[model samples]
Target: MSERTAQLSVRDGRWTLYVALMGVPVSQWPEHHFGAGVVPTPSERSRALTGLGFVFTDGATWAWEEYPEQPDDDTSPVRLLASIRVRSRDGSWS
Candidate 1:
């Protein structure tokens, strides 16, 4: 029930990490199917997050803060995104 806005940049390409968890939807997969019950295993989870290079916002409100290489430094802009996580009805979270 909360919402905010933020942005993030990569490769120092004229962008700063100002984005926050803007639109992250709730857990798509149920806690039981989320990689092995509530959360994924250390190794199994690590491998999944190892190649994370995209931003995903699921239309949900999230906590966000901006440090900006400086305050309101309008010298760069970051690309923000929106992600969607559909909850399965088969009592499975995958």
Candidate 2:
């Protein structure tokens, strides 16, 4: 099994590295969640995760948590990414 790495850009204008396992189908990627707080855009998140050795498939599953306390029209400013499943390209769960 071979590992893949990608260069990711951070807000500081620096490059970072990420790794991932190849051959894993997008449909088989595991699910992930974000803690309460602001999160980066999908592209940024993907790149960052990829830099960390995680693979993200395009059109992967995603979900948002809704706050019932807020009005239906108003969405929570604290956007969280609930369904970004990623794994190592080397085929290791760890």
Give the candidate number with the greatest lDDT: 2
Cα-based TM-score, every candidate: 0.20, 0.38
lDDT of 1 at 82: 24
Which window of ten consecutive residues has the lowest lDDT sum in model 1?
28-37
Off by over 4 Å in 1: 1-72
What is the C-alpha lDDT profile of model 2 across 1-94, one tens digit per residue? Answer: 3333332222233332233235667444442333333454667667556554577544554454434334564653432213445556455555
lDDT of 1 by residue, 26-70 (tens): 332111112212323334322332222222235533333334454
Clash pairs, model 1 backbone: 2-61, 6-19, 7-18, 7-19, 23-57, 23-58, 29-93, 30-93, 57-83
Global local distance difference test of model 1:
0.30
